[model samples]
Target: MDKLALTFELSYYLWGLLTLTIPIAIHLLSKHRGKLVPFAHIALIKVKNSPQLNQARLTQWLLLILRLLMLLVACAILAQLVWSKNADTSANLVLVSNDWLAQSSDAEKQQLFEDLNSSQNSRLFIIDGLNQSLSQRKLESKALLAFQGDTSSTTTPPLNIWANLAEISKTLPKAQKIQLYTTNRLNQFTGQKVAITNPIEWHIKSLPNTLPETKLTASLTIVSDANYQQQLLYVRGALDALATTLPLDLNIEYLDSSLVQEDLDLSQQQSHIIYLADAPLPTELVNSATSIISSEQLQGYTQADFPLTLATKLFAAQTKQWFADNARLSNQQITELPNLDLVNQQQTNTGNAQSLHLWLILILVILFMTERLLSEWPNKHSRQVEGN
Candidate 1:
């Protein structure tokens, strides 16, 4: 955890070890004094027998002292009193799943692949190539060739982002989590606002003078019949380059089996536009029909500087992917994702301080009661003197 916690834990250990000495010392001293006998040389020895030195009294004191020491040692062990470096020997494996649906272009996909490949000891699973099953197969090891064009699944499957994530989680080493890369599409899911606990870091190369917030927008139109009557429709959002083009009056049906029609039209600036017609759609679809048409390229989103709307979107996508992978099995498990070290450190320090305070109070109370008992002890000599 933190230095504070480390210090407190060490101190408790010291206290525990030291406390053991208290009972041992008391036992040794008590055993030695137990042999002391009263001599008949009364002229040289005028000291009176103290109440604390009686055999029964000494035995009682020794028992109490030893009991206290035992309690202290027990408490320390439960508190993790030892300073250890062995805990760090544990290594964690995180499986990262990347899908082609989220990639804006070939170049973007390549860049994303490069990022994923660069990670240390990560297993990559690519889901878009020639052989459907083969393309979706998980890749093991660090070979660079396996990452480029495996001639796998040609058809892009419906984005089963969560299910794919769950598969990755099952493949990963137990106790390790699977990390899914998703866009800012989470807002459509959970209605709650979002915060950036952990934001992806990107060092974009060959970007077209685009700021982190740069976004491109496209409008789609739907025509139901020859009369151009509007109807319920579904729309998917996605992005393409400036030069890339799609055919006009394109006919595409939604996966929900809705009788919707979409037409791609060029904007005044020659940008692609999506048109929908006779769209039989449901408003409460699980996945967002709206695609990440304009993937907002950015440097980074931070906990302090990121917008709530964007954070919500990113959180939704990431969290959804996380759950699909069964990685969120510990969703209720302390999710201080970004600042784990800081949070753990704080908790450990607090626990140690509380322990120390409790022990100190116990010691003080014992000492106070011992002194009061000694002060009020009865005098045996005075009783004998009065009777004579």
Candidate 2:
């Protein structure tokens, strides 16, 4: 049996406790006020203690106490008094990499869902990367409905699981245990692995070698003057590096600015042209190329000043767009793999805390019924006394 801890899921409703005075004030103000009557024969009058009147006064106080109790219980129910367990207590924090979900097969996804459902107190979190920041969102076991479709063409970058883990560790409570479900794709494991004090049980899924074999054909025609030879070298080197990572059979050709012609196959509708010269190319060369990157677009930076990686990425992106039929490959090149065997397997079987709302609701119902019966009891007793 899970060790449950009592907590208020929505403690804001506890503010209603202040309203307990409302019933108290009403009970005090509702006292029966006797009218002052002018009595001429005060010496002949006698006063005696009546048991019925004393019993009636006691019942009124009892009714007041019950009303107060009812109000207090209602507030507790609204506050969602729950019996919950945290990660350190027993619950397991299950973190699922969205990248893994996108790449995983249907059978694998179904198996994951089954595991989550069978786990006693597992909290599911979907790990996603946006703008180089990792954000996690809680998910139910059945929330994988959208993952059943084909998402093979998603262009999102592979997550740096190790770096993300470091960030996650900072925000986690002390001594929490984590069950991480992710792919063991080397590209997904980027950056340095830091030591996390929390115990993590790695459920690493090996990815199949599905690298594309079909090489895309891309041609680049550089039109530049002799003065821009160094700029040409930078462009050429960047493209060479791009070709190795991307499955592309790239072809490069050079043209002198003065030798350009209007009828030249510069805009062959298939090639992308990179103009490196300071002089603007003829309208024919500009209009002919399928896509052109002019000197102005490069920010007029010299070869030494130009950002090679940035230029390469821009070129690679353009190539991918131009040849949409080719398979898009992940740009991350695997360096070193982490030691998965070193991970501690301290997995826990805890789930969401059991809710006490039902019990509170039942108590509220009983309070209402008892309050109604007691409220009528005094009136019923008085009628019987009059009949006597």
Instruction: Indicate the TM-score of model 2.
Output: 0.42
The TM-scores, one per candidate, come to: 0.28, 0.42
| lDDT of each residue in 181-220, candidate 1, tens digit only | 3322221112222222222222212112212121223333
57: Cα error in model 1, Å: 17
Instruction: Give per-residue CA lDDT, model 2, range 59-141, as digits (tens).
Output: 88988888899989899998888766543536667888876677777777788788878888777787765344323377777
How many Å off is the CA of 241 in candidate 2? Answer: 16
lDDT of 2 at 44: 80
> Which 10 residues in a row give candidate 1 its minimum summed lDDT?
234-243
Q: List the residue pairs that clash in candidate 2.
A: 84-353, 121-350, 121-351, 267-288, 267-289
lDDT of each: 0.36, 0.67
Could you tell me how far off, in angstroms, the CA of residue 9 lies in candidate 2 after the best superposition? Answer: 26
Highest TM-score: give the candidate number. Answer: 2
